[model samples]
Target: MGSLRLTFACGDYDRTRALHEGTVRPDGIELISLRLPVEETFFRMMRHHEFEVAELSLSSYVKSLDQDPSPFVALPVYPSRQFRHGGIFVNAAAGIEEPADLRGRVVGTPEWQLTAGVWIRGILADRHGVPVDSVEYRTGGQETPGRIEKAAVDLGEQIRIAPIPEDATLSEMLADGRIDALQSPRVPSTFRPGGGVRRLFADPVAAEKEYFTATGIFPIMHVVVVRRDVYERYPWVAQTLTKALHLAKREAMANLYDSSALRFSLPWLIPGLEEARALMGEDFWSYGLEANRNALATFLRYHHEQGLSRRQYAPEELFAPEATEAFVI
Candidate 1:
């Protein structure tokens, strides 16, 4: 048989490289990496029919599947450490003490439709008694109406108006005091100014825990998916790839600093890498079948409720049969 051709799409090039070098079976798998912007990668996958297996954020993947669900099937790969979303960084001098203080505040965000942003708005509106329509929302571009719509539906009229900008940096805006608070998934170190940016309350993991408690679904961050036809033709590919990824995760975790330093040639990640190594020691990166199914089901249910998708396909329809059967709940 000819070598199996596989392609991976990743958000971080360095992580992708580490996974590629550390995990993939070189002999049987002809793994190729593509460098494409996240938004453009989705369209390119549709246009070129390029990859067999692709890595993608579950939100974006669901959006793509909503456009056409037949070509792709999402597979669970790894679960990232839970991180807070919509980190509201306020100028220390703003005296914004509580969530209610965000009223009439100018907030900066990267993506308007991002799940993090939507969820943050929902929590703030529901818990803080803050009027949803009273705050001003700014996006980098005018092409963020969809995100706005999602937020509006989730938050009601509590969201007042939308601001579009040709070129605006949230960090710079925060530093210059152009915006009162900036919301993002994670706080970048660069965002901290002398007395400008200070973090407000973030949705604790308990909130996410409650979400899981209610729905049996954890919000999916990223997933591995393959074309439906490709899986049909290459039955063994699923097991092969999963095993390879498991091995890769193990090796990478064991030698996190050495591997990361070797790949990046920088010491920036050394400390964090050591911490991650210690934290994730002996913890396998691979998710069992039941865990992945639940995550996907939760994601699909969310998108459906939000009107982002219409059809409700089963979890089995999104992965190889063996993979579906591999890790029974």
Candidate 2:
């Protein structure tokens, strides 16, 4: 039989490189992986419908489904670390110590209705008793209103909405005191810039734990999806890919620093393997079927509640039936 082409997309080049480099089963399958920004991946998936499989943000997945629900099937892939979105970060000189202090302060975000931004706003409204409509929100021209509109239909009015310079980076904004606080994925010590800003309120990990504990929903940051027709044509391909991903996850988990398996998987993508090594950090990556399902279910419920979609469907609707047992949540 000729090789079956399988296309994949991911947000991080390093993570995509790691997946490409690792143990991809060559048994009648030819993996075609593309590393693209989050928006590009969604647009390509919607336009061409050519890829057999894709990795997408859970939020983006929901948004795409809202746009055109017939072309693809989505499955939970893994649970990412709980990212904090609604916390206030201020220069040490600003002296903003609490959520209430964020009032009248300029805040920066990649987008208005991004997962982190929405969740952060929810927390502010629910926990800190902040009215969702009151805070000032600024975006660096990265907000996709169509995407945000769909997400907001499901997530509600969580962001305050403002504008920021197109070229500003979160690190630069926080450093220069151009913005009082910014909502973003939790940054490691290495990613954190030197000096000035201090985390005031809201720990993303702690918030994740609390949200999950209270709601039995773990938000999905990313998911793997496949065309339903592809699965029908090659039933075994799904199983093979899942097994390979499982193996890759295991190998990644077992050794972040040194892994013979990864070194041999995709040498072309990881020229020096230095970026791969850095990403292997404990907090950097995660994968599994059950955890992914749990997060997806949570996101679906959020979507349903927000009215992004008219109905809530089971996670199985998005994945191969045989792989259903592997998804726990």
Candidate 3:
């Protein structure tokens, strides 16, 4: 039989590099790796099913589950995980000293359902008692002039959200103090020089660490997904792809912990690895269903609460049944 050929779309990251570079291979699949910006990947994959496999936005994937005959099915192998404390930026003069301060404010986002925005909102609402519905949300591109929502979002009746003016960007609104705060993965361009934009949590790293210690949820931002046609035709691909990605992550962790030399440009790389293990578990960037239950559950809960998903999806339901279970000796 010919090697099952497939297209794999994802971001270029150390964890996913092994598979992309051919150091590791999914069981029998011949992969055509498409390394693209995650945003582009998610947009194209979700809109047109442009790739057989893709790194999908966790928020989009959760929302997609509600579609009649959803186009793709996800694997527990998350390619991107981010802690969102640093994502919340505020106009220094907005008087938004704390999460609660955002209640009556206008907060802008690249998209309301972007995984980073979702996590930031979830954190603010759940931990800080800043209700999601309390604030007015503005959505648009960051620095670019125009943007469109890639996935359908249902922010529920209680929440208020609207698109920004067609000619304006969120960065402009943030810089000029038009928007009181912004939650996005990218730092608002206005944060430079004399611009008034600043992080809501002044020390984002410290805040993220505290949030992790308190919540045990290092938010997952993206996961691997296969087109429904591909999945149904090749059921083995689910487990095969999951194992390959897990092995790749294992390789990444091993290299990160290697103290011999800096495999990456950053200094204290090994110590950083050790510190992460100390804070999170030894498997800090774990994959698979059971390993990420709390984080997954927390995110889905936010997805439902934020009206992104019609149903409150459980972690087990997110992956193929075969991928969720494996025989052990």
Q: Is candidate 1 or candidate 3 better by lDDT?
A: 3
Q: Estimate TM-scores for all models.
A: 0.65, 0.65, 0.97
Residue-wise C-alpha lDDT for candidate 3, range 1-329, written one tens digit per residue: 98999999999988989999999998899999999998899889888999999999998998888888988888888788888888888888888888889998999999877989888888988889888888999999899878989987755576888999999999889878899999999987788645588888878889999998998888899989999999999999988888888888889888877778888999988777788988998988888777789999998998888888888998888998777663121
Instruction: Kindly list the per-residue Cα lDDT of model 2 for residues 157-254, writing each as its tens digit.
Output: 54456555545455566667777776665441212444677676547446555664665554456667777678777777665666566555656544
Per-model CA lDDT versus the true structure: 0.57, 0.57, 0.87
- What's the candidate order when arranged by decreasing lDDT? 3, 1, 2
Error (Å) of candidate 3 at residue 216 is 1.2
Count clashing pairs, candidate 2: 6
CA shift of 274, model 3, Å: 1.2
Error of 3 at 152 (Å): 2.1
Q: Model 2, stretches more than 4 Å misplaced?
A: 11-19, 35-50, 79-82, 85-88, 91-95, 103-106, 123-131, 141-179, 186-196, 202-219, 228-236, 257-294, 303-320, 326-329
Clashing pairs in 2: 21-265, 21-266, 137-162, 153-306, 154-306, 290-328
